[model samples]
Target: MGIIKLTNIRVYAYHGCLVEEGKIGSDYRVDVSVTANLQPSATSDHLKDTVDYVLVNQIVKEEMAIRSKLLEQVCKRIIKRIFNEIDIAEEASVEVSKINPPIGGNVEMVTIAMTLHRSDYSDPTQL
Candidate 1:
């Protein structure tokens, strides 16, 4: 088993409870960590045999484009997408952060994070 981590993925997206926040958008940083068996790729040295970081990043980007009201929901979507799309990932964790969020005070950012195991996910297609 091994862990693959992607950090500080900067994306400008409109995701917040405030209506104006969605219109103007804000900077977001996402971090993801995936755990899976790496023995196959470790020996084969083939991208096909392992989780692709590029694909992971693309998934995050795609999800970020969709507007959401809460960071927790964003984190949930990211984790679920990774587990569903990336067959090699046995477990996944994600952190979603909004930079300089408008909270009526000086705040650098607000972040929400979540982790899930593959078994915990129920495929939407199946439902």
Candidate 2:
């Protein structure tokens, strides 16, 4: 198995419980990683045979654009989209970080991370 990682995807998005936060928005960083079989692509030298980072990046950007109250929600959407859009992906993990959150203390960032296996979605109760 091989992994494809897209890290430090920066975006400014409105995602928070506070009204001020929704209006003012916050800076966010997203990291996505996927595991898949790369041997086919390695031998064939073809993009179709492996998990594509471009699609992964696009999924992260699109999901981040949508406003959600929690980082976990955002991460779930990103993972779901990656699995739906990328057939070769066996597993996907997403980390969403809110930079300089409004937690009333000196904090660099708050991040929520989640991982999903392709089979996890088969039963909605697991979610």
Candidate 3:
């Protein structure tokens, strides 16, 4: 198995629980890391061996731009879409973070992350 990561992808969008948060919108950053079996690409030297990060970014941005009440739902939707859309990735680890969220505490950020693997594939972590 091999890994390809897209780090600190920035986006501006409306996502939050508060009326002001959803109404005004804010900056968000996503860190997406995907692991796929690399043997095919390594031997064939073909583009089919890996997921295209560029296309993945567009998918992520489109998902984030849509307003959602909770970050968890947003994260889940992205993961699901990735699994269905990106064929090269066998496993995915997605992190979506909001900067300076509208919270009472003095927190600087809040985020939701999920890891999904194709049910048919072997665990990449064991690789």
Candidate 4:
């Protein structure tokens, strides 16, 4: 019933439909929201009981850095990787945006989002 949000994580990478996009690169702003029971961390004041946001950021960054033509695919990769890799996160939503896309029109960015839940997920460490 509680949450910890990681927001405005800007990643500079090459991911677009155009060939120039993959060659020149662009900016991606991602917002990640993780939901989990934080009662243990709140009560014990221990970092171990909660998710480490730094690790999450690294994961997101790594996923975004991978060159992909579609933001939708990149967003899905982020969601699936978090669900399969991160253990402490019970639920997560990844919102990835393409800044100043080459649409040749008036548009700031295009957003692609995906949400995933690890309710029945197995621990990767154990596997």
Writing each residue's lDDT as its tens digit, candidate 2 over 69-103 gives 98889998888788778888889999999999999
Model 4, stretches more than 4 Å misplaced? 120-127
| Comparing 1 and 4 on lDDT, the stronger one | 1
Tens-digit lDDT track for model 4 on 7-99?
Answer: 999989999878999899988799998888888889989888887788789988999889988888887777677666656678888899988
**Tens digit per residue, CA lDDT, model 3, 1-127:** 8888899999999987788887789999899888888788889887766677887898899999889988887877777777777777778888999998877788888889988787743543322
Question: Which candidate number has the best TM-score?
Answer: 2
Per-residue lDDT value at 50 in model 4: 84
**Overall local distance difference test of candidate 2:** 0.89
Model 3 CA deviation exceeding 4 Å by range: 120-127
TM-score of each: 0.93, 0.94, 0.87, 0.88
| Per-residue lDDT of 46 in model 3 | 79
Pairs that collide, model 1: none
How does model 3 fare in lDDT? Answer: 0.82
Q: Would you list the clashing residue pairs of candidate 4?
A: none
| Arranged by lDDT, best first | 1, 2, 4, 3
Worst 10 residues of 2 by lDDT: 118-127
